[model samples]
Target: MSEPTAFLLAMLAIYTLPWLLWRAAGQRSWLPLVVVQIVGGVLAGPAVLGAVFPDAHGALFTPGVLGALGGIASWAVMLFVFVAGLELDLPDAWANRRDTATTAGLALIVPLLIGAATAALVMRDSVWMGVGAARWQFLLGVGLACAVTALPILLLFLERLGILRSPLGQRILRYASLDDLIVWALLAVILVDAEMLGRQAEFATLFALATIAARRLFARANERDRIPLALMWLLVVALGADWAGLHYMVGAFLAGSVLDSDWFGIPVIDEWRDRILTLLMPVFFLSTGLRTRWEMGGMDVIGVALALLAAIVVGKRFGVLLAARILGWAKGEARLIGWLLQTKALIMIIFANIMLDRGVISPTAFTALLLAAVLSTMLAMPMAQRAIAARDADKG
Candidate 1:
């Protein structure tokens, strides 16, 4: 088949197959469409499809086709990350500073410590560590991957649960917002290229100044013009960061972080985010799956995934439960919050993708992380719903 034909065929499959499977599965509440798409991506990847049917896989996922899909996926994720930054509510976090700090801190740190320890054990074999990574870098990367909460996906879950605008939802958002900022900051630190130190410094200085000016411009501009300006800024900053040896996604998050969500209105931002998730992010998921490797053996990858999931679930719950006891929160609140915070779907994948790009983690490590993320996310809704139900029954 011609390249164009192959590319079109691939696009059709990317868009349709996941949705079909999701529908076929009866769209269980515990298994969201996003999770299905992620699993679909893995199923379509080399370890599964390529191994099972190499000729068909090669025909559809040609280098030229993959390259084109990659470009789209890159832009799609940048847009998603930028939106995540824009949605952060720092003012509210400060208003509830003590509680937010205590909860977010423990929620983040516990998982991180557990994940790092797990990483140390996993890395003993050496096959899981990326070629360019130091021991510390690998450990830190894996730890942070475990701690990340996917803010956008969290929003979707909250909305689905009918509590997005409730006090509980807002509180959850605040904790996640704080975690998101710190996680990205640490990622930037990890990505700091020693050889490109000078360029990175220059980018930082210029970016700070540009951010001040952009905020002013955004504040002054009419609503209609703000979106276009934001998109331009996203492109410029993402390019600048990539050139500075920080990944473009880091730049993308920075691009949105400084801007106020109120500038474009929450409804507009919500609609935009939803559209991106619906139309573009599946390609990103597919691209992620294409990178999966199981050279260390499929069972080994599964074992690593399950181990990482255990660390995240246990660490998150223990930390949140600790915080709840200290703060005097009602019974069951900690369990619900813990499950929700441990939902690591897109953000963890994005985090691991960067580590993979920087060679801080191998393809085998990436595959494990990806699998863990999908499983953890699948567990969140059902577990959270049960916690909620149990809480309500006790109150009754």
Candidate 2:
């Protein structure tokens, strides 16, 4: 329509250029892309460049856009969860069950407690919040903090650390798989409580119908059954949920968690899951950055910044460390493991969106928690890496 709309789109192109170049260069590290998504969105956002575009194409930044992006992101995430379930290879995890169980359990529980305590300390008064959360934000924040580390991030990081296939690696991956189960379950409860979902039975009934349909169709599936057919299954059920006023993510996640027992044995199923999750999932992460409001960078944000960031980083990292030590991991490994395990990602965005969808928190608070989340991620990846490397060097 005018020069500005095209110019804004051009800026988006420039921001995406490096990401495309990095992908071409074979980089598996995600930091660069993560940075681009946030920076690009910020540079083009209403808060920062609103004065520039004043009122760009109104539809570009509509609620519908966010909702659609979230749905797509949820699917990408569900694919990863399905792959996680496929990768669990329960027989192997069972062999290493003790360590897997211990680490996963500590990872989920510790951060929650720490988040609750942290929220209690600094969340007095409304602080100009808009999500309707006078106190519930902290409670929700604790759940978000403790139970919601990133499985996808850990998987990527584990491969880089040279520990993904080690004895320790097996434990970590399996532990992450188990932890995702907890995270998804916790997410369901929170979503239903906040009315992002209705009664749990809506999910249960939908799942049961899905189960019967799956058993009949995939009773004797092979790679042929794994591919386009499986993809169709996910799409159909997810769409059905939307038509029924149900959340698709819960359905998709349930589909993933309750994987067919022969999932790993069925090479085709495993292959499809891997390719889709690895490739398509980054779209979810990129959209997460898009949702962030970078205009939050100011004195107005500094107050909650301290409490939220400290709770997510210090409280989570140390609490997991303590639990691991109690579980008999050596102090060095426990600390390192704690750091490795707490890298935040999709869960934060997903849970926070759920809160916003249900009116549990304000848009301003969502922006604040999201800001805290970004700071935590910056702190987490490097810290976990260094801690893990130091422990390895000591062992060496």
Candidate 3:
């Protein structure tokens, strides 16, 4: 088959297969469609499909088709990350500073420490570290991936739980929002390249100046023009960041972080985000799946994934429970909050992708992190539902 035709067929399958499987499971999967999309990607990837049906896999994902898919995946992730950046509502987080800071701090720090320790243990074999990465870089990169929370995915889950506008949900948002900021900032710090320090510095300086000018321009612009202007801004920042060796994903986040979501109309922005996720992000997941490997041994990778999942779940639970005790919250609040905040899906996967791209973690490490993320996300809903239901039963 022609490459273009194969690519089109691949796209068709990528979008359809996950949704079909999702429906086949009676359309009430414990895992969200997004999570299923990821699982489908893994199943379709070289590790499974390519290993089992090598000829078909090779024919469908030729070099040219893979290159085309890569390009689309990169842009799709950039846009998705940009939407994440734009959604940050720092003012609300700061207004509830005590709660936000305390919870966010405990939630982030405890897991980070545990994840760092896990990284240290894994690195004792020297096979888990990425090429050209120092021990600290590897440790920090892996640590933060565990610490991440997918705020958007959390929102989706909360809506399903019928608490999206509830006090509990809002509170979770604040905690996740504050921690999201820290995650991105720490990511930038970890990605700083010594050799490209000058380039990065230049990008930072220029980005600051551009942010001010762009904010002013956006404030005065009509609603109709804001979307295009935002896209233009996304391109500029992505190009500049890539050139500066900071990676385009970082650039994408920074670009959107400086813009006000209100300026673009919250409804419109939300719609755009949904549309992008629907149309483009499946390709990104597929590309990510293509990169997975079990070079360190499948058993070893599974062991590491399970260990990392435990550290993340336990650390988050312990930390949030400690915070609840210190703050004198009602009973069972800690369990609910911890389960919600420990949810890791899209954002954590994005972080791991960046770490892998920068050679701060090997493919084996990336696979482990990816598996942990999927499992953790799939667990979030059922656990939180049971916790909340028990709390209500006790109240009754």
lDDT of 3 by residue, 234-350 (tens): 999999998998879999988988888889767876787788889999999999889888756578999999999998998889889888988888887898989988679889999
* Model 3 ranges with Cα > 4 A deviation: none
Model 3 residue 353 lDDT score:
95
Clashing residue pairs, backbone N/CA/C < 3 A, model 3: none
What do the candidate models score in CA lDDT, each in turn?
Answer: 0.92, 0.59, 0.89
- lDDT agreement of model 2 with the native: 0.59
lDDT of 3 at 140: 85
Residue pairs whose backbone atoms clash in candidate 1: none
lDDT of candidate model 1 versus the reference: 0.92
Per-residue lDDT of 254-320 in model 2, one digit per residue for the tens?
Answer: 6655556474364554465557644555456545545545344445455665666766666556765
lDDT of 3 at 30: 61
Give the least accurate 10-residue stretch of model 2, judged by summed lDDT.
125-134
Q: Sorted by lDDT, highest first, which candidate order results? A: 1, 3, 2
Off by over 4 Å in 2: 2-32, 51-97, 125-138, 193-199, 212-216, 236-246, 260-290, 294-302
Task: Return the number of clashes found in candidate 3.
Answer: 0
Q: Which runs of model 1 end up more than 4 angstroms from their true locations?
A: none
Q: How large is the C-alpha RMSD of every model relative to the true structure?
A: 0.9, 4.6, 1.2
- Give the Cα-based TM-score of candidate 3 against the true structure: 0.97
